[model samples]
Target: MFQDISCLEEIPIPDSLQPTIFIQNSLIKLVKNECVDKFCRIILESEQYKTKIIVEKLAEELVILSQIRQNRFHLISRICQNLFSESYYKEQLRPLLLRRIFRESSYYLLLCLYNDQIYSQNDIMNLILEQKRSDFAMYFAPEFGLIDTSIMIPKQWVKKVIKHLSDYQANDWALFKEYRTLGWLPNSIVAAIKKDDLDALLDFEVDSRFNINNFIEASPLEPFRLPRVNTYMSLAAIFGSINCFKLFYQSDIPVTDRIMHSAIAGGNYEIVRICARSVCDGFEAAIEYRQNEIMDWLLQNSLCKISSAVCMDWNNLLAALYLSDKTETNEILIKGMNEIYEGKAIAMPEIVSSSSNYF
Candidate 1:
């Protein structure tokens, strides 16, 4: 019977305690077979499963067995269905189920739970707050739309996060950027930018509590003199807010090559053009980094001097050649190569020759 447990739906839970123990064992066998739905049925219907210890143990078993394969979602769905339909299970088993999901399923399953809408915002708060894992709260914030609101992050949790941000590091912001689902920051930050609230921005920048040295250290600007100035500039460029970019430009922050690169990366061609003229090595950096649109803009604006000498190096020539699919660019690199090799009998590398069409 264990060899082919597909007929488990036909099996009934025996009434006697000893026979019920046997049935529970058989249900566990089905769990090992990844018959999670059937296992859930046994839990819902079996008299043996009415015993709290037995049910909890089997629930834990189902959670573990589901993890062995790609069947956890099915189990989660069944569990969620049971929670919504059965009040006793929701009251008695919900917290245990949540604790198990948190401990065993990892955050990917947490995200799946969010996507599945199996838990409400209050349910999450109760579950997460009881654990006192503030980091989990922050990580799960976006999923709850806790930080995606138009006004601000919810004030109840905002105080908690604000307190946490007192020791914020650049890496913290980087991690937030990587994991931010809808936008770069809570809507409050975006709203501040939209309104050009420099004072509010400055407050956030110099918030006394923030151990923001990791952020300041990464910047080329002076740490004491508003290290976040270029950061704001980058943010403005990212939003394509030309006026805000100009505001940052006119501020105390010195426009560095890095800022210009940020503008190029943001596709803010106009700001890139303006900064390219004043910022050192903007053209060369653009070429090296394959910022083709910015390079083209720089060339159009008479800002580039990428001539035969510049392309003599194999790497530089390759960058120039591969930066775009335009036929003219291919011709430019080819002509530069010809000019460089005019007096030599050097042969191009096989790789270079083979990739000629890539230009």
Candidate 2:
């Protein structure tokens, strides 16, 4: 009967009985095909001390099969989790098999390999934190059904997870969407913008859970919990992302002098314009930075005037003003120079003539 077993189209391994020799020998080929579900079920139902020894020997091959057929391997992962629950397996098989699986498997398989006993979630968390792979941690959540699943990672751990992942560069929008959909803190939004991920920003604006009213009401870089408003604005300006600055500006966060200067220095014209309409006290800094484009915009839009003091500081100031055909440019320069010379005359010490005093 065993000799002709290989000849059959589908091997009938009953769930009631332990795996036969033929079944064990043909496990690899069977796992690659439709027999995977039945084979995994048999192994899961059987004694781990027996089946685990067989599975451990075929660990590498099983991982490869799982990679090829993820759905099939997901069943295997579930079984591993189940087996890991038993104290005997926890004390014995976990070290022999699951430990190796954690190192060898990808996110999906590793998720299935998750046994909250032998290694707490924090242990894995520490491993990734120690390895500095926290940026990619979000990748594992979906495979574990954490994202969009009914299961909720408690709020405390969620904060820790969010904080760690926020420090890392996240390019996965699905992970980002999950963060938003889950109503996790928007600690990573600034990081996303700094990465110039416009799509992520766009997604945030549209996500139903995104509370724009609350966001706008909070101080600039509110989630940062530090003095990072300048850092926040600088990135938006440097990237020349008008949409980014709009987020802050619309939030009623006072666009500071440093922000305007940075926007001008970065040649972010739209940001400059957005900032110009507000209190722009960085005109001198803009001039210092040689941001002629910004100066031109400021002058052309009457956002700033070339004061007498500014004229005295600039060389050939008259020629610079004469270059613009704003007609009023010449008048402003002439008036400023007149004010300076008149002020100088008024401040000069008067010389009393002795002849006039004698007469």
Candidate 3:
């Protein structure tokens, strides 16, 4: 069953007339089970799958599996290696699987491995150059967790985004035009834009009188500055700051490397992960979106010697902790405390003291 999956991205999800009832029914039932190994069964029954959903279901299972069994991550990688390296199932499985690969902890390691493997086989920079050819078709990147497709730009909405940009650009209070233009509508920007007083807009929002679609018109403003800014760092050319993010390099500011702050402030997971060089941001983005699979992957990886920066943003951190279940909450607190002692976690004392119940 080992298929040449590296070339899988080359294959497209073909439109087929075949019905997917068997696989759909079988997998759905299997997905409902609280086991990760069932994913292997689902994979084994691949012949019955016909739609793109089997890919999603299998991915979900893999993530669940990884979260609970960090030691087995090598096995997980092998499964992935098999799917991508084989040709027989390449067209049918690879396309759907790679999209979900980043959702697994194995992906983080695999990406590093691919970098080394490709270097041995070819040139290093050439591999980085080839990345753009991957499904970065939209402004968002899955490496950042699922892109906020809700912020997607259609041809028709281009005018709406631009019109708002022109109107908001002149206002110092609305410096978020750049982020909005980049295809992101961060929740912080959403709450930050309304003038610092109770107004008709706020009223309309509370009373459900305002059009929710108006969210696309608002953007993130640079209200807060990184006092420890990376001297030569320029936010100008950071094109997808609103929707996606690049990794934080050695040039990054350790004191201000709050992954959650970067993520929810702009809602970009890539920026979040980039800062999480060692610590976990509690999977702030996925938690915000109730993306259980993504959150699971993060928690699993955090156990493997990962860490984040200081100056932790409370709003995002609290949101993540509260959104968790009993097991998740305890794990988060323990891991967070350990990181704090190790100086990997950010300090937000007031937040640590206050207890908010999350549903």
Candidate 2 lDDT, 1-359, residue by residue in tens:
01122222332322321233233234424534345555555655666325543445445334544433214444555445555656665566555554455455244444444532434576566555544443224545533323332233333434555566544235544554444332233445655564556678777768787653332211221111122234555546644567777775676767766667667655566777677776655565444333444555565556655442342343223223434234454444444444433353221112111112211
TM-score of each model, paired residue for residue? 0.33, 0.29, 0.24
lDDT of 2 at 177: 46
Give the local distance difference test score of model 1.
0.48
TM-score between model 2 and native? 0.29
Q: Candidate 3 local accuracy as lDDT?
A: 0.35
Quantify how close model 1 is to the true structure by its C-alpha RMSD in Å: 23.0
TM-score winner between candidates 1 and 2: 1
Model 1 bad stretches (over 4 Å):
1-37, 103-105, 145-359
Q: Which runs of model 2 end up more than 4 angstroms from their true locations?
A: 1-55, 95-98, 112-120, 129-359
Alpha-carbon local distance difference test for all models? 0.48, 0.46, 0.35
Q: Write down the worst ten-residue block by lDDT for model 2.
A: 347-356
lDDT of 1 by residue, 1-359 (tens): 01222222332322322332333334323433246456456567745455565446445644543332232454565556654466667666666666776565244455556677776667776766666654446656555433323332343434545566533324545534343332233444443543456665556656676332222121111111112344556555544567767766776567776677566544556777667667744565454333444555565556555542233332234334434346654554454345333423243343245455443
Task: Candidate 2: give its CA RMSD in angstroms.
Answer: 30.1
- 39: Cα error in model 3, Å: 4.1
